[model samples]
Target: MKSNVGSVDRIIRILVGVVLIALAVTNVIGWWGWLGLIPLITGLVGFCPLYPMLGLSTCPLKKRQ
Candidate 1:
């Protein structure tokens, strides 16, 4: 898939996902926190499936010659 997620977006997603997972592992949150895997995978992959459906993209546009 094309990388619709930019650097900053990816970083934020990774951080949020990590936090959620950490909380889950620490038993500070419910099992739902395991859902954090979603963002983590997407961020690592640099693509968001929802972004396509929503017609959104954080990637910088390529310059045309």
Candidate 2:
């Protein structure tokens, strides 16, 4: 899939994901923190389904081969 997440977006997602996971593991945010997996997965994969549904894309233009 073409990348839909930009560098800044990916960074934010990773940061948020890490925080959520930490909070969950430490029992500070409860099981709800598990939901962070959504951002984590999307960030790692660089493809966000919701972005397309919302007609949003932060990725840079790609050069044609």
**TM-score of candidate 2 versus the correct structure, residues matched by position:** 0.89
Per-residue error (Å), model 1, residue 47: 0.5
My TM-score estimates for the predictions, one after another, are 0.96, 0.89
Put down candidate 1 lDDT per residue, 24-54, tens digits, no spaces: 9999998999999999999999999999999
Q: Write the per-residue lDDT of candidate 2 for residues 1-65, one digit (tens) a residue.
A: 87999999998998898889889999998999988888888988999999988999999988999
- Candidate 2 Cα misplacement greater than 4 A, ranges: 63-65
| C-alpha RMSD by candidate, in order | 0.5, 1.7
Candidate of highest TM-score: 1
Model 1 pairs in collision: none
Evaluate residue 30 in candidate 1 and report its C-alpha lDDT on the 0 to 100 scale: 85
Go through the candidates in order and give each one's C-alpha lDDT: 0.96, 0.91
